[model samples]
Target: MERQRMSTSEELMHLPWWMVLLEGIAALIIGVLLLTSPGMTTLVLTQVLGFYWLIVGVLALVNLFVDHSLWGWKLCSGILGILAGLVIIRHPLWSTLFIPALVVLVLAVQSLIQGGIKIFEAFRGGGFGAVILGILNILLGVVLLSAPLMAAFVLPLVVGIFALIGGVAAIFGAFRLHNSALRASIQQTPT
Candidate 1:
């Protein structure tokens, strides 16, 4: 018998359900922390962003070596991410300019990029929810970019709101993953 290849969604379903739950819980906790202490969160967020970019850059570079299909794009993205990460990490004060406006600008650009990716994924069978999230992220980025000064004042609140929404969505996703895993397990069990 020929073995059938699994779709992306099916492959994802094979992931341990507990990991999804943990991720959801972690997001909820971080969201609450950011909401409760925006001032401190801002500083931490900068460092976090730096580390995140660095890690992603490293992963992308590794992926380029592992999968040569999109090596050029991956190489460019990885180099940019690494450079940005290093610059931000080394001169966070310069990046922020001791002003929240700069931070908002950075976040806006990041959101715009992420939103575009999400939108593309949504078109590729990701689901309507992804489209909605992509639109929202793009709108947030546009709003911040359009009025960066104004965005600085409300940056914390806006971030808080988005974080909460993301947390909730993650939680819901966790449940869905759990259900899928349970069903898969049940189906696999012999009578």
Candidate 2:
């Protein structure tokens, strides 16, 4: 019997190599720039964050129209994104100073929720990685709360590293998205 072909969405999981390399390079550049001048990074980061929020909000809103099942999540994500973006747009300088603390707070909350979800998934016998990530998040959140000053100082560097890693992963994932045959082979491989 012939193997069933993977769908485009499934293939998207395995992105192309060039895309991954590009993403990695971009992330590395951003990381290096941030590391070299952390003080200046504050203003730049605020602007970037503002734009990111707007983009994400728009994306969420777009998804709401396209996928009704995600209406609740999409609406909340969009509204939050828009609000965050607007705050930055209104007082970018003030926002720059406060963004770090807010970022930590938001991330801490996100980590808690993500960790909880991971723990639940692990209990259901799925995604051990999620559980590990969840634990890491919990630790990170505690560290951020306990040592806010230290966290504020070092958070940018850490964010740079995360961006580099995420970019690389996205690039790699993009390749997977492009390679249907490879995706099938990988999926067929026994875990």
Candidate 3:
């Protein structure tokens, strides 16, 4: 018998419904915590991120042995990730302050570049939608640059609200998926 290959979508569909439910539950908890206590939640989440980076760095280095490909990239990334994680973990308060501001600055630069591209595209007949989007992106970039600290401070609240909404959506979707899977299983079973 020849083996069949499963595409990404098919592979995803094969994941157990309960796994999605567990993910939903975790998201819901994190969302509630984020909303109720943004400051503390952000701090804890940052630490978690640091730990995650550390683990990923170690894993990347280990994977170099399993696969000889891209050793240089892996080695550089692993070292950078480990150093960054250690710095963040060792200086939690400083990390908490610096990371958001860094993110804002990076976003501002990205937005400005994206806006320029969009505007250029519009000039090349991309349409009115592109013009509007380009203008909006430029405006956003300016705003982020002008008050990066303020934006950084508000970032947690914004993220919290988004998380809360996404968590609810995920939970509902999980239930729907679970029911659909159940129905499909019943339909396939012999009576």
Worst 10 residues of 3 by lDDT: 1-10
Q: Please give the lDDT score for candidate 3.
A: 0.84
Compose the digit string of candidate 2's lDDT tens values, residues 1-191.
13335555444444555666687778877777777787677778788889899889999999999989969989999999988988897888888768787777787777777778878888888777878987887887777677666677777888877877777677666565557556677899999
Question: TM-score-based ranking, best first?
Answer: 3, 1, 2
For all candidates in order, the CA lDDT equals 0.81, 0.77, 0.84
Model 2 scores worst on lDDT over the 10 consecutive residues at 1-10
User: How many clashes does each candidate structure show, in the order listed?
Assistant: 0, 13, 0
Query: What TM-score does structure 1 among the candidates reach?
Result: 0.56
* Candidate 2 Cα misplacement greater than 4 A, ranges: 1-14, 58-77, 106-143, 162-191
Tens-place lDDT per residue, model 3, 1-191, is 12344565455456776777777778777777777887788788889888888888888899889998999999998888898889889988888888888999999999999999999999999999999999999999999999999998888878777777777777777777777778888999999
In the range 1-191, model 1's lDDT, one tens digit per residue, is: 13344566777687676777777777777778768887667767777788889889999999998999989999999998898888878987655434478788898999999899999999999999899989999998998899987778677767777877787887788789988878878999999
Task: Record all residue pairs in model 1 with backbone atoms less than 3 Å apart, i.e. clashing.
Answer: none
Looking at candidate 3, what is the lDDT of residue 87?
Answer: 86
lDDT of 3 at 53: 89
In model 1, what is the error at residue 81, expressed in angstroms? 4.5
